[model samples]
Target: MTISQAESHKHLIRTKVWSQLRKVALPDSRFHHDYSSFIADFEGSSAATDLLVSLPAYKNADLLFIAPDNCIQALRYRALKDGKTVLVTTYGIRRGFWILDPNEIHESKWEMASMLDGMERIGRHIALAEITKLPMDIGLMVTGTGAINYKGLRFGKGHGFFDLEWAILYTIGKVNKKTKTIAVVHECQVLDEELRGEVWDTGCDFVVTNKKIIEVEDASKPNCGILWDKLEEGMLEDIEPLRELRSMKK
Candidate 1:
């Protein structure tokens, strides 16, 4: 299929999954109207987090790279409580990346620090160059998904922020082959059909739901760094981190 056709198919899948999620997803007062536009906070999010923490990858990892999705809030809280450092991007990656170290936060504020609003307030802003200078050993990488299949193909909220984030990290050597990637979603979000993934699509090694854990065999992920030609227009101008990264590359 052509690139246009492939994208259209992915959009259809996202729309269908979003509609299904709305029925069972927990209500978010912050985004009451446009549930489809954002990743739905589905029921059993806490349960999913519980399962994720039980994994060996999570237990052994000192640093985690988590996406800024509402469903993964519980996981973030648990990570901090367990004394794990988290690397997260601002919402839509609009403001760039932040480093949330458990050592820096007060124990009483961990729960608050896990939330998006709290993360922005409490987390320290780290530039791209600074991040590269830090330790690059990320053991577990978790992201919230709009839809995923047994093959580990994942679809986000149309925007490619997560994929870009991965590319940036991979390019900077923060993420390596040993890093275990997982996608947390509701059972309803797991698709039976094989998704046609693009070259730049980032897949997961595992899919965690409230019900069970699925270990994907040979998950597909981007093998290269940033695909400069595939980036959206004005992304560099809008996201400071990207601009900083671009300058570093030059």
Candidate 2:
């Protein structure tokens, strides 16, 4: 099926799963255990091993990860505290709620604060780097899967910003074989189908959800021209510093 067709199908599934989750209200204890299982499983898994073997030393590795909220996997703070350099996006208020960075949320800052705390738990030094300023040698891009509907392919609310975020990194030559891109989500989010590829979507090498870590093997890389095109579209307009940097690049 075409990418658009796949996206549409996944969108429907995501809506269904979300409705189910709301009716059931995932319990806190279950959430905690699933996250813990992922941390433990990945710690000894091939994905983790491959990441360390392939990438440069984390002692100097620049890491970019997301701050999670809205029922995403609650990654423990221990991992964050052990990293080298960390980067985070800012949260904004929308539709009577506060959404985490680059997205809209309708809730209070308390949830956002909790997400920030998880990001801080990694305890790595903060480096306010945009996609443009991202050091050429970033070792990993770890993200928490926010409401991945559509069988884990399409991202939250269809803005496609997360894929753009990765594409920006790829376009700038910051991500390569050695750079690890991992997503943390709950088990239920993993779809039973291939995540449809698109011209702009950033394909992840590792998926760490509630059940286990899924490593997408022999994954297709984003097209260079398409990636640059994404970078050219004044996509960073909302990001002030990024906008300034892009202007300088121009």
Residue-wise C-alpha lDDT for candidate 2, range 79-105, written one tens digit per residue = 233433334443311101111222222
Maximum-lDDT candidate: 1
lDDT of 1 by residue, 16-94 (tens): 8878888878776777636555666788988899898999999999989999888898899999999999999887788
Candidate lDDT scores, in order, read 0.85, 0.43
lDDT of 1: 0.85
TM-score computed on alpha carbons, candidate 2: 0.58
Separate clash counts for every candidate: 0, 16
Candidate 2 accuracy as lDDT: 0.43
